[model samples]
Target: MAYNVLSVIPARKGSKGIPRKNLRQLGEDPLVAHAIKKSKKSNWIDHVALTTDSQEIAQIGRQYGVDTIIDRPTRLATDEIPLAPVIEHAFEEVDHEFHYVLCFQPTAPLVSVDSIDEGIEAGIDSNADSVVFVRDSTHIYWRDGENGYEPVASDRKNRQQMDEIYQEIGIFLSENHIVRQGRRVGDSSEFYEVGMYEGIDIDTYADWILAESQLQRKQVLYRLIGNGNAGTGHVYRGITIADRLFEHDVLFAVEATEDLAIEKLEESNYDYQIFENEPSFLDYVRSTQPDVVANDILDTSAEYIKSLKEYTSRVVNFEDLGAGTDHADAVINALYEHSNPPENHYFGFKYFCLRNEFRYADPRTAIPSVERIMISFGGTDENNLTAKTLRALSDLDHELHLDVVLGLGYTDQGSLDSVTATYPPNISVEINQNVQSMAEHMEQADLLITSNGRTLYEAGSLNVPVISIAQNHREQKHPYAHISRGVLFLGQAEYVTEENVRTAVEEYVTEREKRETMREALEGHDITNGVERIKQIMFNQNNAD
Candidate 1:
């Protein structure tokens, strides 16, 4: 049996909490317009009837393309008058007969079209006289003065374990006859559960503000400070995470010295601003007033984090171990692993933000012998480790190909040029190559020589046996690059001589068993899901307050 559903949007001019609340602008449209749009888009709604006392509201309803405009009398528009009379007045105005009346309050703009259709279907299927839109209010309860505070139900179970308690979210579906009698529900009534986000009801000024904020997209400021001294790992990590958060408006904030970081942001077509100093950066952040600030500048100072917290509601730091980490709402240290980190600090390989190319690429199968070797030491080899590794590989007596991957920030082109000129027929260098091809190179190569940085995790995901050389003492502490994880961590680059690289390369090349074992061990780690895990943590932290 088909039911003719009449969607009634009641918008009164007078509001005690917020004057003209229904007509007030919410984002691009007015509060009442939201309900009008939802009703018009609904598949179950046969006709939309907007009830209002004010002529201005009637004009607005006509502009919104409502089929019937019910001019509610001043007597029935009083605050003391209930919603049932106003709905009944609307039913008397419309010519077409409707089986059910969907009372969609203008104050509850968050109501979705799907919920309207679903509620109607549920009410029809259950053969109920009325249906109401509800949200799970399991833990919430009222208290009596004499009895003090007590659980609403006898069973004081966990919120998830407790029986679902739903509260009406201002959307009511009632039989046309019951509504005509000034009653929202008869004896039989059912309910449709809408998501918490969609069940938001706007009544007061605070509620309107909250509803408006929910409707608008959040501004996510990514503070990524990377330079020649500090490799481009932070920049890449910031971009990777920002790319995943398509729902939010992402903006990159970098230092002037971070040219490579700026270039990457530009290449990705992301909005960004370069700050000359800390003061300027802080000023910019203050001016923007971002909802959330994701700091990817390694260690953050207490004062810096405090200043950021002053403007932004949520502050997230990436790979931060400084005094500021304690102040940040969430800290993600994916490169370094700590035995017992703070509750906010999410450490280890589980939070490693891998690039889409590496995360989606299939892990390379271990070959019988090391035929082709790939060398990658992050975006900026500040220590000139690339040349050092190249020099070391020059001494290799074995007849095997060496593919040298140069970073964008690798300034010492003279050293690289000299190495290429003198490079034996076996060695070849590819400078400033596309990052997307990095995964392909990792797949083709039998062995990888890289710094103990972000690339280590990427290589591990690819199941490539790696000889990790630490750029500094900090990189050496990375647990993922440890020997236990199958990475032959050749100490700091400053101490690593040409002989050390030659010897390590030769050992890995000759020893097939060791390479295969290392490949198996690296593949055991779940690094592909790190982006999603970190996203969840950030989302939780953003909503923690």
Candidate 2:
């Protein structure tokens, strides 16, 4: 059996906070037009009605093809009046026998028609008196008392450990007969839950600003890979970009074997999924219909980029040296620059997206004596560069401190301990593994021995000179770590022996003028604001399209 549902949008002309708010422009349509158009688009709503005391709102409704324009009295439009009487008046004036009445507010432009239809279905299938929308509230409560304000509960807990509290949002549904009794909620009620950002209601200027931002938001997908061999730079880069795009919808997709990537995202607030192959990932992308797809998997095939372009308007890639770079809308390679490159390529250290810690890092003045040196390869240093560098630096025969930073995915954490046992008592070794404080160690170190990957740029952001080595032939192709960027690049992993690393460290330590020159070179280039640069490139092109 089909049930007849009437959706009512009650928009008063005058608002206490924002004048003429209902008739104000939101995107291409006025605020009141959103509810009317949504009601007409719904699968369950049978009729759409608009009730307002202002003729401006009525005219706006007529333009959106509302079924009826009911005149609401001025008395019922005041701030103190309850919504039930206005809904009742609308139900009576529509003249059609509607089995249900839906109350949708103009302030809630982010609520989708699908949520509305589900609320109606939930109300009718259960034969409930009313249905309301709610979201989880994490706020702690304190009540006023004779002495002062006191905790509502005797027990205190962190927000993450607090009991769940649900607060009502902007949509309501009720049976027509129940609404006619001048009541919105009766003995029976059902709750429909909405997401935190989706339940945004516009009342004050701050809320209006948030609603406008949400309205312009887009959905993005980050496809990348991470492992013991390839390192976790891609996953960390994706997290950096996603954090900047908080207003937009961002998701991370990795393979089932990417346990390192999974562990990293698990510690974050963002959500992710595991895919079996390209076809399954594309199917998920097709279903979600994201506005853009960002490929950070190092190198991509032409067919894969084409497949992504089939669903989204823009496809952006990172550090791509493959043929798929031609098909992408944009390619950002912060470590390498291309000669005779395509018009879409953005290369150089100016596009480096620093981690959150390095963005606000303290300015460094150098220790002058080069007492501390940081040795970090990456998350999973397959080459055991930290051990090699530590062993080589132990031959310095001076009082030196070595800070070895290991990521969550380092497979050779134990091998470093074996190497440190062989170190001289004057050369102390401390390994900081699976820790989030990498920037603090880097700040204290006078120099760093890192791979020719993303870590070198992080060193440059803090003006830390580096002795760079390539873990593989592909990383050897990274061009930004040469003498111009405060880094001295050694050959690939198989060729860079202990003698080469020890000699390079001795030069930076004994020669203060060389370290000062490297610091001046790092200061000549800007590399911290690359997140905002990439964000503008992704969002501005989508908006133009």
- Among these predictions, the greatest TM-score belongs to 2
lDDT of 1 by residue, 55-159 (tens): 888888888899988888899899899999889988888888899999999877887788878888999889899998898877846567477977567666777
lDDT of 2 by residue, 426-501 (tens): 7888888776777888888889899888888888888888889998888888888764658888789999999999
What are the clash counts of all predictions, listed in order? 0, 0
TM-score per candidate, chains pooled: 0.63, 0.89
Q: What's the lDDT for candidate 1? A: 0.82
Q: Candidate 1 at 340: error in angstroms? A: 0.8
lDDT per model vs. reference: 0.82, 0.84
Give the TM-score comparing model 2 with the true structure, all chains together.
Answer: 0.89
Off-target runs (Cα >4 Å) in candidate 1 are 1-217, 420-436, 541-545
Model 2's alpha-carbon lDDT is 0.84
